[model samples]
Target: GGAGGGGGRNRGGPGGGPPKASGKKRHRLASLPPSALLARVERRGGGGSFPVHCVAGGKLLELNQRLALEPRLLYDRPCREGYVAILFPSPDAARQLRSRLLSESEYLRVRGLSAEDLL
Candidate 1:
């Protein structure tokens, strides 16, 4: 837990490290443009098993953040092949991820189609 993984908590997870930021703003894109959250949720990837919500804008969207670590789906489940997990801020981000998935060879065939076809 030292630094082997990634994005070490601002001070580590509630145990020991640097003291957590006192007044660091929480990510709140949902309350920001309003449309940002709506767009993010509408994107294909947003419909997945991971949890999502709108965070206000002012705060920069870090690919990795310390708090509000929401649930992520297993890599091998429906998306990410069990490796990559993403927390999307806006629908466009989701769409970008989805487009990435769609354009890639590994995920393309499985992209944009219905479950019935997969069956």
Candidate 2:
């Protein structure tokens, strides 16, 4: 309805500056296969350029391949700064792979990266 769970934030906190945008909302990634290898992508310039995370099979993170793809994702391999690759799993689980990288990816701390593997 209202851009998922990203709504209803108390903007009048602290100094009472304009309310900082609340975190993102988590949604189910639809249509996937079982145990398939996939990737989650949080493209740059989406907003604050915040961090995004995804996991599969004990953190299916092949830094070299993915790091290059998202120059903005923040992965120097072996370790990431803040928000960069903020997770080992997609902050959730799936039959195969999971990613909070799309418009559906949950917001900051929104929780549960469940994917729909109807295959």
Candidate 3:
């Protein structure tokens, strides 16, 4: 789960240069535990009548009672609207998590995979 792939090159940056090394080390987003929710649960058409929970430090944080009415919004625009929930342990933790996320090519390269492999 270490973020040490793509040969230290930063993708989508100006001139596609190397990622600037921060004073703090960059971690890998994959290092965190997966969400506890089950993805294969039944989905109601109009609205998702499911409970969303966030587990942090042995405590369960129950978020919304139901998901959005149009679940297709999740698939249509994942980055903007698709997330199940977000957990912010602290400001520093959120910052760390943001820094660890991989760029497109980095993610594929880290797993020794390609976009075609996903299909």
Clashes of each: 12, 10, 0
| Candidate 1 C-alpha lDDT tens digits along 1-119 | 11112221121334332122222245442123322221111112333222222332222333323232421222112333221113334566555545544444444454544445333
Error of 2 at 46 (Å): 11
In candidate 2, what are the lDDT values of residues 1-119, reduced to their tens digit? 22221212111223522122222332322222233323223333342222222234333222233343434323221223212222233334543343334344443234333334111
- TM-score of each model, paired residue for residue: 0.21, 0.19, 0.32
Give me the overall lDDT of model 3: 0.36
In model 3, where is the ten-residue run with the lowest total lDDT?
1-10
Q: What is the RMSD of candidate 2?
A: 16.5
lDDT of 1: 0.29
* Candidate 3 per-residue lDDT over residues 1-119, each given as its tens digit: 11211111111123432122222223422122334332222233323233222233211222221223445433333344544444335455556656867987997797676677544
Error of 3 at 50 (Å): 12
Worst 10-residue lDDT window for candidate 2 reads 2-11
Lowest-sum lDDT 10-residue window in model 1: 2-11
